[model samples]
Target: MTIKLLAIGKTDNKLLASLITDYQNRLGHYIKFEFEIIPDLKKVKHLSETQQKEKEGALILSKLAATDTLILLDEKGKQMHSIAFSEYLQKYMNSGIKQLVFVIGGPYGFSEAVYNKAQGMLSLSKMTFSHQMIRLFIVEQFYRAFTILKNEPYHHR
Candidate 1:
Protein backbone atom coordinates (compact mmCIF):
# COMPACT_ATOMS: atom_id res chain seq x y z
CA MET A 1 0.00 0.00 0.00
CA THR A 2 1.15 3.55 -0.67
CA ILE A 3 1.43 5.83 2.38
CA LYS A 4 0.51 9.49 2.05
CA LEU A 5 1.03 12.38 4.45
CA LEU A 6 -1.27 15.37 4.06
CA ALA A 7 -0.35 18.43 6.03
CA ILE A 8 -1.42 22.07 6.07
CA GLY A 9 1.11 24.71 5.00
CA LYS A 10 4.77 24.43 4.04
CA THR A 11 7.82 24.36 6.22
CA ASP A 12 9.86 27.46 5.47
CA ASN A 13 12.59 26.58 7.94
CA LYS A 14 15.55 25.28 5.98
CA LEU A 15 16.86 23.02 8.75
CA LEU A 16 13.51 21.33 9.29
CA ALA A 17 12.99 20.96 5.56
CA SER A 18 16.38 19.30 5.17
CA LEU A 19 15.70 16.83 7.97
CA ILE A 20 12.25 16.04 6.59
CA THR A 21 13.73 15.48 3.15
CA ASP A 22 16.38 13.10 4.52
CA TYR A 23 13.78 10.93 6.22
CA GLN A 24 11.55 11.02 3.17
CA ASN A 25 14.42 9.66 1.09
CA ARG A 26 15.10 6.93 3.64
CA LEU A 27 11.42 5.96 3.80
CA GLY A 28 11.27 5.73 0.00
CA HIS A 29 13.66 2.76 0.23
CA TYR A 30 10.96 0.73 2.00
CA ILE A 31 7.52 1.80 0.83
CA LYS A 32 5.87 4.20 -1.57
CA PHE A 33 5.52 7.45 0.41
CA GLU A 34 4.12 10.77 -0.67
CA PHE A 35 3.94 14.08 1.20
CA GLU A 36 1.42 16.62 0.03
CA ILE A 37 1.04 20.07 1.52
CA ILE A 38 -2.11 22.12 1.49
CA PRO A 39 -1.30 25.77 1.16
CA ASP A 40 -2.09 27.98 4.15
CA LEU A 41 -5.09 30.21 3.96
CA LYS A 42 -4.57 33.82 2.98
CA LYS A 43 -5.80 36.87 4.98
CA VAL A 44 -6.39 35.02 8.22
CA LYS A 45 -6.79 38.22 10.23
CA HIS A 46 -10.52 38.49 9.51
CA LEU A 47 -11.61 34.86 9.68
CA SER A 48 -12.68 33.29 12.94
CA GLU A 49 -11.15 30.03 14.20
CA THR A 50 -14.23 28.05 13.27
CA GLN A 51 -14.29 29.53 9.80
CA GLN A 52 -10.65 28.73 9.29
CA LYS A 53 -11.19 25.15 10.36
CA GLU A 54 -14.19 24.76 8.10
CA LYS A 55 -12.27 26.01 5.07
CA GLU A 56 -9.29 23.85 5.89
CA GLY A 57 -11.57 20.88 6.48
CA ALA A 58 -13.05 21.33 3.04
CA LEU A 59 -9.60 21.23 1.52
CA ILE A 60 -8.63 18.14 3.49
CA LEU A 61 -11.82 16.33 2.57
CA SER A 62 -11.37 17.21 -1.08
CA LYS A 63 -8.12 15.24 -1.23
CA LEU A 64 -9.61 12.00 0.08
CA ALA A 65 -11.19 9.15 -1.82
CA ALA A 66 -14.18 7.08 -0.72
CA THR A 67 -12.08 4.01 0.04
CA ASP A 68 -9.18 5.80 1.63
CA THR A 69 -8.69 5.27 5.35
CA LEU A 70 -8.13 8.66 6.94
CA ILE A 71 -5.92 8.84 10.01
CA LEU A 72 -5.34 12.06 11.87
CA LEU A 73 -2.27 12.86 13.90
CA ASP A 74 -3.87 14.28 17.00
CA GLU A 75 -2.81 14.81 20.58
CA LYS A 76 -5.69 12.83 22.03
CA GLY A 77 -5.22 9.94 19.63
CA LYS A 78 -3.78 6.49 20.29
CA GLN A 79 -0.09 6.19 21.01
CA MET A 80 2.00 3.20 19.96
CA HIS A 81 5.59 2.09 20.22
CA SER A 82 7.75 1.94 17.13
CA ILE A 83 7.37 -1.83 16.78
CA ALA A 84 3.64 -1.63 17.23
CA PHE A 85 3.47 1.06 14.59
CA SER A 86 5.31 -1.24 12.21
CA GLU A 87 2.71 -3.90 12.86
CA TYR A 88 0.03 -1.33 12.23
CA LEU A 89 1.60 -0.61 8.85
CA GLN A 90 1.79 -4.32 8.15
CA LYS A 91 -1.90 -4.75 8.94
CA TYR A 92 -2.89 -1.99 6.53
CA MET A 93 -0.73 -3.49 3.78
CA ASN A 94 -2.22 -6.92 4.43
CA SER A 95 -5.69 -5.51 3.99
CA GLY A 96 -4.86 -4.71 0.35
CA ILE A 97 -5.49 -1.04 0.68
CA LYS A 98 -4.57 1.21 -2.25
CA GLN A 99 -3.51 4.09 -0.02
CA LEU A 100 -3.21 4.91 3.68
CA VAL A 101 -3.64 8.64 4.24
CA PHE A 102 -2.33 10.37 7.37
CA VAL A 103 -3.18 13.98 8.05
CA ILE A 104 -1.77 16.85 10.10
CA GLY A 105 -4.41 19.45 10.66
CA GLY A 106 -4.05 23.23 10.77
CA PRO A 107 -3.02 25.39 13.75
CA TYR A 108 -6.42 25.34 15.42
CA GLY A 109 -6.63 21.60 14.80
CA PHE A 110 -9.27 19.82 12.73
CA SER A 111 -12.83 20.82 12.15
CA GLU A 112 -15.86 18.71 13.09
CA ALA A 113 -16.14 17.56 9.51
CA VAL A 114 -12.57 16.37 9.35
CA TYR A 115 -12.99 14.52 12.64
CA ASN A 116 -16.08 12.80 11.32
CA LYS A 117 -14.22 11.55 8.25
CA ALA A 118 -11.25 10.10 10.08
CA GLN A 119 -11.16 6.35 10.73
CA GLY A 120 -8.47 6.52 13.38
CA MET A 121 -6.10 8.91 15.11
CA LEU A 122 -2.55 8.62 16.50
CA SER A 123 -0.34 10.74 18.70
CA LEU A 124 3.43 10.68 18.56
CA SER A 125 3.95 12.09 22.03
CA LYS A 126 2.22 13.65 25.02
CA MET A 127 4.12 16.86 24.44
CA THR A 128 2.80 19.37 21.96
CA PHE A 129 4.88 20.04 18.85
CA SER A 130 4.77 22.65 16.16
CA HIS A 131 2.99 21.61 12.98
CA GLN A 132 6.24 21.87 11.00
CA MET A 133 8.13 19.79 13.56
CA ILE A 134 5.44 17.12 13.47
CA ARG A 135 6.15 16.58 9.77
CA LEU A 136 9.74 15.72 10.53
CA PHE A 137 8.82 13.49 13.45
CA ILE A 138 6.21 11.51 11.54
CA VAL A 139 8.49 10.92 8.54
CA GLU A 140 11.33 9.79 10.80
CA GLN A 141 8.97 7.47 12.61
CA PHE A 142 7.84 6.01 9.31
CA TYR A 143 11.44 5.31 8.40
CA ARG A 144 12.11 3.82 11.82
CA ALA A 145 9.04 1.60 11.63
CA PHE A 146 10.05 0.23 8.23
CA THR A 147 13.61 -0.43 9.30
CA ILE A 148 12.37 -2.25 12.39
CA LEU A 149 10.06 -4.34 10.25
CA LYS A 150 13.00 -5.35 8.09
CA ASN A 151 15.19 -6.15 11.09
CA GLU A 152 17.52 -3.35 10.13
CA PRO A 153 20.03 -1.81 12.54
CA TYR A 154 18.50 1.69 12.48
CA HIS A 155 16.39 1.24 15.59
CA HIS A 156 18.22 0.13 18.74
CA ARG A 157 15.20 -1.17 20.63
Candidate 2:
Protein backbone atom coordinates (compact mmCIF):
# COMPACT_ATOMS: atom_id res chain seq x y z
CA MET A 1 0.00 0.00 0.00
CA THR A 2 1.08 3.55 -0.62
CA ILE A 3 1.57 5.47 2.66
CA LYS A 4 0.78 9.17 2.79
CA LEU A 5 1.49 11.59 5.63
CA LEU A 6 -0.70 14.67 5.63
CA ALA A 7 0.20 17.42 8.06
CA ILE A 8 -1.63 20.70 8.67
CA GLY A 9 1.22 23.13 7.98
CA LYS A 10 4.62 23.50 6.41
CA THR A 11 7.82 22.98 8.40
CA ASP A 12 9.26 26.46 8.82
CA ASN A 13 12.44 25.42 10.63
CA LYS A 14 15.21 24.63 8.18
CA LEU A 15 16.88 21.98 10.34
CA LEU A 16 13.63 20.09 10.92
CA ALA A 17 12.79 20.28 7.24
CA SER A 18 16.15 18.77 6.29
CA LEU A 19 15.80 15.90 8.78
CA ILE A 20 12.28 15.17 7.55
CA THR A 21 13.54 15.15 3.98
CA ASP A 22 16.31 12.73 4.89
CA TYR A 23 13.90 10.23 6.40
CA GLN A 24 11.48 10.66 3.49
CA ASN A 25 14.20 9.72 1.07
CA ARG A 26 15.21 6.72 3.18
CA LEU A 27 11.59 5.54 3.44
CA GLY A 28 11.20 5.67 -0.35
CA HIS A 29 13.79 2.92 -0.67
CA TYR A 30 11.43 0.49 1.08
CA ILE A 31 7.91 1.60 0.22
CA LYS A 32 5.85 4.15 -1.64
CA PHE A 33 5.69 7.15 0.72
CA GLU A 34 4.30 10.63 0.22
CA PHE A 35 4.48 13.64 2.53
CA GLU A 36 1.92 16.36 1.89
CA ILE A 37 1.78 19.70 3.67
CA ILE A 38 -1.60 21.34 3.78
CA PRO A 39 -1.20 25.08 3.95
CA ASP A 40 -1.92 26.67 7.34
CA LEU A 41 -5.19 28.50 7.63
CA LYS A 42 -5.12 32.28 7.31
CA LYS A 43 -6.87 34.90 9.47
CA VAL A 44 -6.66 32.65 12.48
CA LYS A 45 -6.81 35.68 14.81
CA HIS A 46 -10.40 36.24 13.72
CA LEU A 47 -11.53 32.64 14.06
CA SER A 48 -12.17 30.78 17.28
CA GLU A 49 -10.42 27.47 18.00
CA THR A 50 -13.52 25.52 17.06
CA GLN A 51 -13.86 27.38 13.78
CA GLN A 52 -10.23 26.78 12.93
CA LYS A 53 -10.61 23.09 13.64
CA GLU A 54 -13.75 22.87 11.54
CA LYS A 55 -12.10 24.61 8.61
CA GLU A 56 -8.95 22.50 8.95
CA GLY A 57 -11.01 19.35 9.20
CA ALA A 58 -12.73 20.20 5.93
CA LEU A 59 -9.39 20.68 4.22
CA ILE A 60 -8.10 17.41 5.66
CA LEU A 61 -11.19 15.57 4.48
CA SER A 62 -10.88 17.06 1.01
CA LYS A 63 -7.53 15.33 0.54
CA LEU A 64 -8.94 11.91 1.31
CA ALA A 65 -10.35 9.44 -1.21
CA ALA A 66 -13.50 7.43 -0.58
CA THR A 67 -11.52 4.19 -0.31
CA ASP A 68 -8.48 5.50 1.51
CA THR A 69 -7.88 4.25 5.04
CA LEU A 70 -7.55 7.33 7.24
CA ILE A 71 -5.48 7.28 10.41
CA LEU A 72 -4.90 10.21 12.69
CA LEU A 73 -1.76 10.85 14.73
CA ASP A 74 -3.55 11.89 17.87
CA GLU A 75 -2.52 12.47 21.47
CA LYS A 76 -5.29 10.24 22.75
CA GLY A 77 -4.63 7.47 20.29
CA LYS A 78 -3.15 4.03 20.81
CA GLN A 79 0.52 4.01 21.68
CA MET A 80 2.67 1.10 20.53
CA HIS A 81 6.27 0.02 20.59
CA SER A 82 8.47 0.19 17.52
CA ILE A 83 8.13 -3.53 16.82
CA ALA A 84 4.39 -3.33 17.16
CA PHE A 85 4.30 -0.39 14.79
CA SER A 86 6.24 -2.37 12.22
CA GLU A 87 3.70 -5.13 12.66
CA TYR A 88 0.93 -2.61 12.15
CA LEU A 89 2.50 -1.63 8.85
CA GLN A 90 2.66 -5.30 7.90
CA LYS A 91 -1.01 -5.66 8.72
CA TYR A 92 -1.90 -2.84 6.32
CA MET A 93 0.31 -4.25 3.61
CA ASN A 94 -1.43 -7.57 3.95
CA SER A 95 -4.89 -5.98 3.81
CA GLY A 96 -4.72 -5.08 0.14
CA ILE A 97 -5.30 -1.40 0.77
CA LYS A 98 -4.44 1.10 -1.97
CA GLN A 99 -3.50 3.94 0.35
CA LEU A 100 -2.97 4.37 4.06
CA VAL A 101 -3.15 8.02 5.08
CA PHE A 102 -1.97 9.30 8.48
CA VAL A 103 -2.78 12.88 9.35
CA ILE A 104 -1.35 15.36 11.86
CA GLY A 105 -3.96 17.92 12.60
CA GLY A 106 -3.65 21.65 13.42
CA PRO A 107 -2.43 23.17 16.71
CA TYR A 108 -5.71 22.65 18.54
CA GLY A 109 -6.00 19.06 17.34
CA PHE A 110 -8.51 17.30 15.10
CA SER A 111 -12.16 18.17 14.92
CA GLU A 112 -15.01 15.76 15.70
CA ALA A 113 -15.65 15.19 12.02
CA VAL A 114 -12.06 14.28 11.37
CA TYR A 115 -12.10 11.94 14.35
CA ASN A 116 -15.24 10.22 13.08
CA LYS A 117 -13.76 9.71 9.60
CA ALA A 118 -10.63 8.00 10.83
CA GLN A 119 -10.24 4.23 10.65
CA GLY A 120 -7.70 4.32 13.48
CA MET A 121 -5.47 6.60 15.56
CA LEU A 122 -1.85 6.35 16.66
CA SER A 123 0.14 8.22 19.28
CA LEU A 124 3.86 8.76 18.98
CA SER A 125 4.35 9.62 22.62
CA LYS A 126 2.52 10.67 25.75
CA MET A 127 4.54 13.89 25.85
CA THR A 128 3.49 16.76 23.63
CA PHE A 129 5.50 17.70 20.56
CA SER A 130 5.38 20.61 18.17
CA HIS A 131 3.58 19.94 14.90
CA GLN A 132 6.77 20.47 12.86
CA MET A 133 8.80 18.18 15.12
CA ILE A 134 6.16 15.47 14.94
CA ARG A 135 6.59 15.39 11.18
CA LEU A 136 10.25 14.52 11.55
CA PHE A 137 9.64 11.96 14.31
CA ILE A 138 6.92 10.13 12.41
CA VAL A 139 8.93 9.95 9.22
CA GLU A 140 11.99 8.70 11.03
CA GLN A 141 9.95 6.09 12.86
CA PHE A 142 8.46 5.00 9.56
CA TYR A 143 11.95 4.51 8.22
CA ARG A 144 12.91 2.62 11.35
CA ALA A 145 9.84 0.43 11.07
CA PHE A 146 10.76 -0.50 7.52
CA THR A 147 14.29 -1.25 8.54
CA ILE A 148 13.03 -3.50 11.31
CA LEU A 149 10.78 -5.26 8.83
CA LYS A 150 13.75 -5.95 6.59
CA ASN A 151 15.89 -7.19 9.48
CA GLU A 152 18.22 -4.25 9.10
CA PRO A 153 20.50 -2.93 11.85
CA TYR A 154 19.10 0.59 12.00
CA HIS A 155 16.69 -0.37 14.79
CA HIS A 156 17.79 -2.21 17.93
CA ARG A 157 15.78 -4.20 20.42
Candidate 3:
Protein backbone atom coordinates (compact mmCIF):
# COMPACT_ATOMS: atom_id res chain seq x y z
CA MET A 1 0.00 0.00 0.00
CA THR A 2 1.10 3.54 -0.59
CA ILE A 3 1.71 5.51 2.62
CA LYS A 4 0.97 9.22 2.74
CA LEU A 5 1.65 11.79 5.42
CA LEU A 6 -0.32 15.01 5.46
CA ALA A 7 0.78 17.73 7.85
CA ILE A 8 -0.42 21.29 8.23
CA GLY A 9 2.12 24.10 7.73
CA LYS A 10 5.69 24.11 6.45
CA THR A 11 8.75 23.75 8.68
CA ASP A 12 11.39 26.45 8.24
CA ASN A 13 14.26 24.68 9.95
CA LYS A 14 16.69 23.64 7.23
CA LEU A 15 18.22 20.81 9.22
CA LEU A 16 14.88 19.32 10.07
CA ALA A 17 13.71 19.61 6.48
CA SER A 18 16.87 17.92 5.24
CA LEU A 19 16.52 15.03 7.65
CA ILE A 20 12.84 14.57 6.83
CA THR A 21 13.82 14.40 3.19
CA ASP A 22 16.49 11.85 3.98
CA TYR A 23 14.09 9.49 5.69
CA GLN A 24 11.43 9.99 3.05
CA ASN A 25 13.94 9.03 0.36
CA ARG A 26 14.87 5.92 2.28
CA LEU A 27 11.22 4.90 2.44
CA GLY A 28 11.05 4.87 -1.37
CA HIS A 29 13.07 1.65 -1.46
CA TYR A 30 10.51 -0.27 0.59
CA ILE A 31 7.13 1.30 -0.15
CA LYS A 32 5.62 4.14 -2.07
CA PHE A 33 5.44 7.21 0.24
CA GLU A 34 4.06 10.65 -0.20
CA PHE A 35 4.47 13.69 2.04
CA GLU A 36 2.27 16.68 1.46
CA ILE A 37 1.99 19.91 3.41
CA ILE A 38 -1.18 21.88 3.93
CA PRO A 39 -0.55 25.59 3.92
CA ASP A 40 -1.12 27.29 7.27
CA LEU A 41 -4.33 29.22 7.69
CA LYS A 42 -4.08 32.95 7.28
CA LYS A 43 -5.20 35.79 9.59
CA VAL A 44 -6.22 33.60 12.52
CA LYS A 45 -5.86 36.39 15.11
CA HIS A 46 -9.62 36.84 15.30
CA LEU A 47 -10.64 33.21 15.15
CA SER A 48 -11.14 31.34 18.39
CA GLU A 49 -9.27 28.08 19.00
CA THR A 50 -12.34 26.07 18.13
CA GLN A 51 -12.90 28.03 14.97
CA GLN A 52 -9.28 27.60 13.96
CA LYS A 53 -9.41 23.86 14.46
CA GLU A 54 -12.61 23.64 12.48
CA LYS A 55 -11.11 25.49 9.54
CA GLU A 56 -7.92 23.49 9.65
CA GLY A 57 -9.94 20.32 9.96
CA ALA A 58 -11.81 21.16 6.79
CA LEU A 59 -8.54 21.58 4.92
CA ILE A 60 -7.17 18.34 6.31
CA LEU A 61 -10.23 16.38 5.29
CA SER A 62 -10.17 17.84 1.81
CA LYS A 63 -6.86 16.10 1.05
CA LEU A 64 -8.12 12.57 1.54
CA ALA A 65 -9.26 10.00 -0.96
CA ALA A 66 -12.54 8.24 -0.13
CA THR A 67 -10.76 4.90 0.38
CA ASP A 68 -7.71 6.13 2.24
CA THR A 69 -7.30 5.02 5.83
CA LEU A 70 -6.88 8.19 7.88
CA ILE A 71 -4.79 8.02 11.03
CA LEU A 72 -4.14 11.07 13.13
CA LEU A 73 -0.90 11.61 15.02
CA ASP A 74 -2.64 12.81 18.13
CA GLU A 75 -1.62 13.37 21.74
CA LYS A 76 -4.42 11.08 22.91
CA GLY A 77 -3.61 8.37 20.37
CA LYS A 78 -2.44 4.83 21.10
CA GLN A 79 1.25 4.77 21.90
CA MET A 80 3.43 1.82 20.87
CA HIS A 81 7.06 0.88 20.53
CA SER A 82 8.84 0.87 17.14
CA ILE A 83 8.53 -2.89 16.62
CA ALA A 84 4.84 -2.82 17.36
CA PHE A 85 4.45 0.05 14.92
CA SER A 86 6.21 -2.07 12.30
CA GLU A 87 3.76 -4.87 12.97
CA TYR A 88 0.88 -2.42 12.80
CA LEU A 89 2.00 -1.40 9.34
CA GLN A 90 2.38 -5.04 8.36
CA LYS A 91 -1.29 -5.56 9.10
CA TYR A 92 -2.22 -2.68 6.83
CA MET A 93 -0.03 -3.94 4.01
CA ASN A 94 -1.52 -7.39 4.32
CA SER A 95 -4.97 -5.80 4.03
CA GLY A 96 -4.16 -4.62 0.49
CA ILE A 97 -5.13 -1.01 0.96
CA LYS A 98 -4.39 1.54 -1.73
CA GLN A 99 -3.31 4.27 0.64
CA LEU A 100 -2.71 4.81 4.33
CA VAL A 101 -2.77 8.47 5.32
CA PHE A 102 -1.48 9.88 8.63
CA VAL A 103 -2.07 13.49 9.54
CA ILE A 104 -0.52 15.99 11.93
CA GLY A 105 -3.13 18.60 12.66
CA GLY A 106 -2.79 22.29 13.36
CA PRO A 107 -1.63 23.85 16.64
CA TYR A 108 -4.97 23.43 18.39
CA GLY A 109 -5.47 19.84 17.13
CA PHE A 110 -8.24 18.17 15.16
CA SER A 111 -11.91 19.08 15.04
CA GLU A 112 -14.89 16.79 15.61
CA ALA A 113 -15.31 16.03 11.93
CA VAL A 114 -11.67 15.08 11.44
CA TYR A 115 -11.73 12.87 14.51
CA ASN A 116 -14.83 11.10 13.30
CA LYS A 117 -13.33 10.41 9.89
CA ALA A 118 -10.15 8.84 11.20
CA GLN A 119 -9.72 5.05 11.19
CA GLY A 120 -7.22 5.27 14.09
CA MET A 121 -4.83 7.52 15.99
CA LEU A 122 -1.17 6.95 16.90
CA SER A 123 0.97 8.73 19.44
CA LEU A 124 4.72 8.86 18.90
CA SER A 125 5.31 9.91 22.47
CA LYS A 126 3.44 10.99 25.59
CA MET A 127 5.39 14.24 25.61
CA THR A 128 4.28 16.98 23.26
CA PHE A 129 6.53 17.92 20.37
CA SER A 130 6.74 20.90 18.06
CA HIS A 131 4.74 20.39 14.87
CA GLN A 132 7.90 20.83 12.82
CA MET A 133 9.90 18.41 14.94
CA ILE A 134 7.11 15.84 14.76
CA ARG A 135 7.55 15.86 10.99
CA LEU A 136 11.09 14.58 11.30
CA PHE A 137 10.26 12.10 14.03
CA ILE A 138 7.37 10.50 12.17
CA VAL A 139 9.31 10.24 8.91
CA GLU A 140 12.22 8.68 10.70
CA GLN A 141 9.94 6.25 12.47
CA PHE A 142 8.39 5.25 9.18
CA TYR A 143 11.84 4.49 7.89
CA ARG A 144 12.72 2.58 11.03
CA ALA A 145 9.50 0.57 10.86
CA PHE A 146 10.26 -0.48 7.32
CA THR A 147 13.79 -1.45 8.26
CA ILE A 148 12.53 -3.56 11.12
CA LEU A 149 10.01 -5.25 8.87
CA LYS A 150 12.75 -6.12 6.39
CA ASN A 151 15.13 -7.42 9.05
CA GLU A 152 17.58 -4.71 8.16
CA PRO A 153 20.20 -3.51 10.61
CA TYR A 154 18.78 0.00 10.57
CA HIS A 155 16.65 -0.84 13.60
CA HIS A 156 18.55 -2.56 16.46
CA ARG A 157 15.66 -4.60 17.82
Candidate 4:
Protein backbone atom coordinates (compact mmCIF):
# COMPACT_ATOMS: atom_id res chain seq x y z
CA MET A 1 0.00 0.00 0.00
CA THR A 2 1.09 3.56 -0.69
CA ILE A 3 1.08 5.96 2.29
CA LYS A 4 0.38 9.56 1.44
CA LEU A 5 0.55 12.67 3.62
CA LEU A 6 -1.51 15.66 2.60
CA ALA A 7 -0.89 18.81 4.60
CA ILE A 8 -1.96 22.43 4.31
CA GLY A 9 0.70 24.93 3.24
CA LYS A 10 4.37 24.42 2.40
CA THR A 11 7.14 23.88 4.91
CA ASP A 12 8.93 27.24 5.04
CA ASN A 13 11.68 26.52 7.54
CA LYS A 14 14.75 25.13 5.76
CA LEU A 15 15.72 22.92 8.70
CA LEU A 16 12.26 21.36 9.05
CA ALA A 17 11.96 20.89 5.29
CA SER A 18 15.32 19.11 5.18
CA LEU A 19 14.41 16.76 8.01
CA ILE A 20 11.03 15.95 6.43
CA THR A 21 12.76 15.21 3.14
CA ASP A 22 15.27 12.93 4.81
CA TYR A 23 12.55 10.89 6.54
CA GLN A 24 10.49 10.73 3.36
CA ASN A 25 13.48 9.26 1.52
CA ARG A 26 14.08 6.74 4.29
CA LEU A 27 10.41 5.66 4.25
CA GLY A 28 10.55 5.10 0.48
CA HIS A 29 12.82 2.08 1.01
CA TYR A 30 10.04 0.20 2.85
CA ILE A 31 6.87 1.39 1.12
CA LYS A 32 5.68 3.84 -1.48
CA PHE A 33 5.25 7.27 0.19
CA GLU A 34 4.00 10.56 -1.15
CA PHE A 35 3.89 13.97 0.55
CA GLU A 36 1.58 16.60 -0.89
CA ILE A 37 0.90 20.18 0.20
CA ILE A 38 -2.39 21.96 -0.23
CA PRO A 39 -1.73 25.65 -0.76
CA ASP A 40 -2.85 28.01 2.00
CA LEU A 41 -5.95 30.02 1.40
CA LYS A 42 -5.65 33.60 0.17
CA LYS A 43 -7.16 36.69 1.89
CA VAL A 44 -7.89 34.92 5.13
CA LYS A 45 -8.76 38.20 6.85
CA HIS A 46 -12.02 38.34 4.96
CA LEU A 47 -13.20 34.86 5.81
CA SER A 48 -14.47 33.38 9.06
CA GLU A 49 -12.90 30.31 10.67
CA THR A 50 -15.74 28.11 9.49
CA GLN A 51 -15.44 29.40 5.95
CA GLN A 52 -11.73 28.78 5.91
CA LYS A 53 -12.19 25.26 7.18
CA GLU A 54 -14.90 24.59 4.64
CA LYS A 55 -12.66 25.84 1.83
CA GLU A 56 -9.64 23.92 3.08
CA GLY A 57 -11.82 20.89 3.58
CA ALA A 58 -12.89 21.12 -0.03
CA LEU A 59 -9.26 21.22 -1.17
CA ILE A 60 -8.38 18.32 1.11
CA LEU A 61 -11.30 16.26 -0.13
CA SER A 62 -10.47 17.00 -3.76
CA LYS A 63 -7.09 15.25 -3.52
CA LEU A 64 -8.63 11.97 -2.47
CA ALA A 65 -9.57 8.96 -4.64
CA ALA A 66 -12.79 7.01 -4.20
CA THR A 67 -10.95 4.00 -2.83
CA ASP A 68 -8.54 5.83 -0.57
CA THR A 69 -8.89 5.44 3.19
CA LEU A 70 -8.86 8.87 4.80
CA ILE A 71 -7.19 9.37 8.15
CA LEU A 72 -7.04 12.70 9.89
CA LEU A 73 -4.26 13.82 12.23
CA ASP A 74 -6.56 15.42 14.72
CA GLU A 75 -6.30 16.70 18.28
CA LYS A 76 -9.18 14.50 19.35
CA GLY A 77 -7.78 11.46 17.52
CA LYS A 78 -6.78 8.15 18.99
CA GLN A 79 -3.25 8.24 20.42
CA MET A 80 -0.91 5.29 20.19
CA HIS A 81 2.68 4.38 21.03
CA SER A 82 5.28 3.93 18.28
CA ILE A 83 5.09 0.16 18.53
CA ALA A 84 1.33 0.18 18.38
CA PHE A 85 1.53 2.53 15.43
CA SER A 86 3.71 -0.02 13.69
CA GLU A 87 1.00 -2.57 14.27
CA TYR A 88 -1.52 -0.12 12.91
CA LEU A 89 0.50 0.17 9.71
CA GLN A 90 0.79 -3.59 9.51
CA LYS A 91 -2.97 -3.98 9.87
CA TYR A 92 -3.60 -1.65 6.97
CA MET A 93 -0.96 -3.35 4.85
CA ASN A 94 -2.59 -6.70 5.49
CA SER A 95 -5.97 -5.26 4.51
CA GLY A 96 -4.76 -4.82 0.90
CA ILE A 97 -5.47 -1.13 0.57
CA LYS A 98 -4.14 0.75 -2.42
CA GLN A 99 -3.67 4.11 -0.72
CA LEU A 100 -3.93 5.32 2.87
CA VAL A 101 -4.08 9.08 3.07
CA PHE A 102 -3.42 11.11 6.23
CA VAL A 103 -4.23 14.78 6.29
CA ILE A 104 -2.81 17.67 8.35
CA GLY A 105 -5.32 20.43 8.23
CA GLY A 106 -4.92 24.21 8.29
CA PRO A 107 -4.79 26.56 11.31
CA TYR A 108 -8.51 26.28 11.93
CA GLY A 109 -8.42 22.51 11.67
CA PHE A 110 -10.89 20.42 9.67
CA SER A 111 -14.48 21.07 8.79
CA GLU A 112 -17.45 18.85 9.62
CA ALA A 113 -17.41 17.49 6.09
CA VAL A 114 -13.78 16.40 6.35
CA TYR A 115 -14.45 14.71 9.68
CA ASN A 116 -17.36 12.80 8.20
CA LYS A 117 -15.20 11.39 5.41
CA ALA A 118 -12.38 10.02 7.57
CA GLN A 119 -12.07 6.33 8.40
CA GLY A 120 -9.99 7.09 11.49
CA MET A 121 -8.10 9.80 13.34
CA LEU A 122 -4.73 9.67 15.09
CA SER A 123 -3.15 12.00 17.57
CA LEU A 124 0.61 12.31 17.67
CA SER A 125 0.55 14.12 20.98
CA LYS A 126 -1.86 15.76 23.37
CA MET A 127 -0.09 19.10 23.08
CA THR A 128 -0.61 21.18 20.00
CA PHE A 129 2.01 21.45 17.27
CA SER A 130 2.54 23.75 14.34
CA HIS A 131 1.17 22.43 11.08
CA GLN A 132 4.64 22.56 9.52
CA MET A 133 6.20 20.79 12.48
CA ILE A 134 3.54 18.06 12.39
CA ARG A 135 4.60 17.25 8.83
CA LEU A 136 8.12 16.49 10.04
CA PHE A 137 6.91 14.50 13.05
CA ILE A 138 4.46 12.36 11.07
CA VAL A 139 7.01 11.47 8.38
CA GLU A 140 9.61 10.59 10.99
CA GLN A 141 7.06 8.39 12.75
CA PHE A 142 6.23 6.69 9.45
CA TYR A 143 9.95 5.95 8.99
CA ARG A 144 10.19 4.68 12.54
CA ALA A 145 7.12 2.46 12.15
CA PHE A 146 8.50 0.87 9.00
CA THR A 147 11.85 0.25 10.69
CA ILE A 148 10.12 -1.42 13.60
CA LEU A 149 8.15 -3.60 11.22
CA LYS A 150 11.28 -4.70 9.33
CA ASN A 151 13.36 -5.22 12.50
CA GLU A 152 15.82 -2.62 11.34
CA PRO A 153 18.53 -1.14 13.58
CA TYR A 154 17.35 2.42 13.09
CA HIS A 155 14.52 2.19 15.64
CA HIS A 156 16.84 1.15 18.45
CA ARG A 157 19.62 3.47 17.39
User: What stretches of model 3 exceed 4 Å from their correct place?
Assistant: none
TM-score of each: 0.98, 0.99, 0.99, 0.98
lDDT assessment of candidate 4: 0.96
Estimate, for each residue in 3-94, the C-alpha lDDT of model 2 and write its tens digit: 99999989999999999999999998999999999999999999999999999999999999999999999999999999999999999999
lDDT string for model 3 (1-157, tens) is 9999999999889999999999999999999999999999999999999999999999999999899999999999999999999999999999999999999999999999999999999999999999999999999999999999999999885
Model 1, which residues run further than 4 Å from truth? none
- Per residue, candidate 1 scores C-alpha lDDT tens digits across 1-157 of 8899999999989999999999999998999999999999999889999999999999999999899999999998999999999999989989999999999999999999999999999999999999999999999999999999999999998
lDDT of 4 at 64: 99
RMSD (CA, Å), candidate 1 to true, equals 0.7
lDDT of each: 0.96, 0.96, 0.96, 0.96
> In candidate 4, what are the lDDT values of residues 1-157, reduced to their tens digit?
9999999999999999999999998898999999999999999999999999999999999999999999999999999999999999999999999999999999999999999999999999999999999999999999999999999887873
Model 2 Cα displacement at 107 (Å)? 0.5
Regions of model 4 farther than 4 Å from truth: none
Checking candidate 4 for backbone clashes, the offending pairs are: none
lDDT of 1 at 70: 95
Clashes of 1: 0
Evaluate residue 8 in candidate 1 and report its C-alpha lDDT on the 0 to 100 scale: 99
Worst 10 residues of 4 by lDDT: 148-157
Give the clash count for each candidate.
Answer: 0, 0, 0, 0
